[model samples]
Target chain A: MSDLKKLGVEVLSMSVDSIYTHKIWQEEELSKMVEGGFPFPMLSDAGGKVGQVYGVYDEDAGVENRGRFIIDPDGVIQAIEILTPSVGRNDAELFRQVQAFQLVRASKGKEATPAAWQPGEPTLKPGPDLVGKVWQVWKPK
Target chain B: MGEEELDLGCARPTGGPVGVQPDQVPPEREGKSIEEVRKPMVSVGKKAPDFEAPAFYEGKFKKIKLSDYLGKWVVLYFYIRDFTFV
Candidate 1:
């Protein structure tokens, strides 16, 4: 969250925990994080209304799944990643995506980030530049 | 050579009109600028998905809705676990 703050990215975290549980956790855990200095608003979605809209609610699991959606400033869904319960969200990858989105926005849609691509990294041009450039950057074992 | 052959010399690649650079046009003057066309995942364009429910904000039960941030950018992120080290 701080990394995103450094990049000027605003973030809101929502959870499926009930208000009672959220309050308890906030007082017990979040207060410590704050003293330790974790800065960001934690939202509660106890009814799972938000999760339903994003398709992250797991009825069987009785909790929201790990889902991340990068919405552009225009309100359009740019990127959506929903991970299974067993998996975890990658903060580094999310940071890279945020950077890539910023680059795409800065370029005014002339370019897009390729797979596993990072900011300031070479991007493909969707035609002749696709194969050669992609191969050059492809990490081989 | 035929007139067609003569015209071929002036033709640009992609068989479109020559001497017109699309980027040369001012973004605003163009019908759809890249900024105007590309929509962000969360804000400024489409109405954000409405979410109205009970939430503890500041103090007390408050109604939090997507409409609350009609004009502002809102990033709603969700995680499966809390207080767990990955």
Candidate 2:
């Protein structure tokens, strides 16, 4: 998230705990992260209302699942990655998707980014003509 | 492409458009582990559901709503607990 902040992206962390729990955790653990302190607001979804909205609430455990959502500027979900509790999220991959999505969005339906596309890397142009010749222009990285 | 592809604060992928009821998962499964949680209702390319929650920000607890942020990209992520065994 510290890296993403450089790209002008805002990060909001959520948990099913309360403000007090987050305060203590932020002070003792999150503040000691590799990037220094967690550079974002942490939301306390006390009643799991937002959690259920996010499909991350585990009704049985009364906790949440590890879910990541990338929302566009227009209030739409552009990407979704949900994982189990023991799995950690790939922060770098999240950054990649965010960059790719922004690039495609700026193209205004003219360009399509292929898998593992990085910034400044070539993106594909979607059209009937370019259908069968995908290998002709896009080289695998 | 999903709105999750965008960087805005929204729910993650599940299926076509995120307009389902929040608690579609039955409440009877509370004792199960996190791994058994039902699949998400929201997915890529869907309208993210708006919600309100108490967020700890700026040294205080504030009521933050998904609708509160408009015209900006948001990356909303949820973790199981605070200071847990990851």
Chain A only: TM-score per candidate: 0.79, 0.93
Residue-level error in angstroms, candidate 2, position B52: 1.4
The numbered model that scores best in DockQ is 2
**Candidate whose lDDT is highest:** 2
**Prediction RMSDs, each to the true structure:** 19.9, 8.6
Q: Write the per-residue lDDT of candidate 2 for residues B1-86, one digit (tens) a residue.
A: 11122122454211211223435545865666443543454778886777655556655555566765767678999899998967
Error of 2 at B26 (Å): 20
In terms of docking quality, model 2 is: acceptable
Candidate 1 regions with alpha-carbon error over 4 angstroms:
A33-38, A125-141, B1-48, B53-64, B67-74, B81-86
TM-score of each: 0.63, 0.79
**Candidate 2 C-alpha error for residue A93, in Å:** 0.4
lDDT digits (tens) for residues A39-124 of candidate 2? 77777777576677678888899998998899988879999888989888888899899898888888887999897888888889
Give the per-residue Cα lDDT of candidate 1 at B71.
Answer: 34
Q: Which predicted model would earn the best TM-score?
A: 2
